[model samples]
Target: MEDVNPRIAGHYDELAELWDDIVASPSRERLLWETFEGLLPDLEGKRVLDAGCGSGFYAARYVERGAEVTGIDLSADMLERAREQVPDAEFVQADLTQPLDFLDDDGIDVICCQHAFSHLEDLSVPLSEFARVLVDGGVLVVSTHNPVHDYVVVREGEYPTETMPGDMEATVETESATPVYDETERYDIVWNSGPDSNRATYYRRSIEGLFSPVLDAGFEIRDVVEPTPDEAFTRENPEIAAGFKQDAAKSVCLKAVR
Candidate 1:
């Protein structure tokens, strides 16, 4: 928890210029978008909701495809940058852990959230809210770090100081549990400043990618795609590019229809 809401927003506001370049580097996100492209059935006049839409990169693609798009984020700074790049999208600011303020009941045709889940203390509430905002038979697409493919590589283990060119594999399995963040929350992590500070993220997910929520939310799993990148990702890691035939390095795609 941060007390500096204004500073938090300002940090992103100041950092907004390099936001896209920093996150989508080597174009892995194009693969993420290709996953969305595969999931969208048809969007000639559909209404789409992009939750946690940081900078509207995903929303702009939907808008271009003729879907009316609304995007929401917790950071007003990110929303500002999104507005500059994607003027046609409806962008707003809202806390994702709570019910949304800007949406109407059964008003959305599709729900798309990327790199945003598991940031909250719990998944059940937001999952329910996603169902509430969507019309019946609509869709929800969520892309996340594939806990299935590479959890042990990230925890209770080590990576080379640099990612070397090789087939990296480990047989170790890890399980992560997410409980509401009470004052008594516990972690065994050893915290430090340098690599840990800038690179640290706080939440964890259930093992490997599971589908309990889609069933609970009443959406059917349509497709789970690990889409290929547009030229940039392949150039960075030819091995990784081909391995999409098997798994993803940092993220996985989940497409469910309401």
Candidate 2:
């Protein structure tokens, strides 16, 4: 765990510029934001925690919706960009896998962790921290890479990759290596940022393995959403949209209440 955070942080630091472009794509994140935001309660005057908040993309939205947002990320470079981009929100360099000592018990109204769970080996640690920090009946919104989609990606060895082209062009590409997807284990994935690519480690877990920790941490599951591409995504990247509907969703979002 000690070495993993640094490597993950380094990967983000290197790709921070490219990531800014990728996260800004409306076609890529529209459905994800819809699903994530649809589950939240009123954000007006609420204290929101954007856990593993890379570059403050969602934190900006939370602030716009009248929430007091605090964003945390492991990458210093990402935090720097986040601070610059969202001046109203607080940015902190913190690790989700460790205890979040900066926060007090039952202090947060909502916690949103998006696309960050894949980097952690165990979900229990972070989920426990979330439960501890969230007041009773508080909301927890999380999104992660879909294990079902990962299973197909590993079995097929090829997938329709979404690139940062203005039109969001997707092409079927073959993977150099395919890792086992059935077991709960850590594996490396090559993330492409436009012309540049880098390898980062991620955990692949079964659906049961994914949600058991949330339940154990005393969160009552409210909704599990598999977000489909929006109309713009379908119009720009029809082939990729078709493949996603035919096989599995690329990501799954969950809303839980403490």
Top TM-score prediction, candidate number: 2
lDDT of 1 by residue, 1-258 (tens): 543234334434544565676456433445665665677768769998898788877788888889999998777768988998899999988777678756888999888888666455456677788888899988888876555433434354432211211232222222244333222121222222123122223244444224675677677887776555547667876765665544444566888877
Candidate 2 residues lying further than 4 Å off, grouped into runs, are 163-182, 191-197, 230-233
The whole-model C-alpha lDDT of candidate 1 against the native structure comes to 0.63
Residue-wise C-alpha lDDT for candidate 2, range 9-57, written one tens digit per residue: 8878876766678776553567677888888889999999999899887
Candidate 2: lDDT of 164? 51
* TM-score of every candidate: 0.72, 0.88
Q: Count the backbone clashes (under 3 Å) in each candidate.
A: 3, 0
Leading candidate by lDDT: 2
Q: Rate the local accuracy (lDDT) of all candidates.
A: 0.63, 0.81
Candidate 1 residue runs with Cα over 4 Å from true position: 1-15, 156-200, 208-210, 227-236, 239-248
Cα error, candidate 1, residue 135 (Å): 0.7
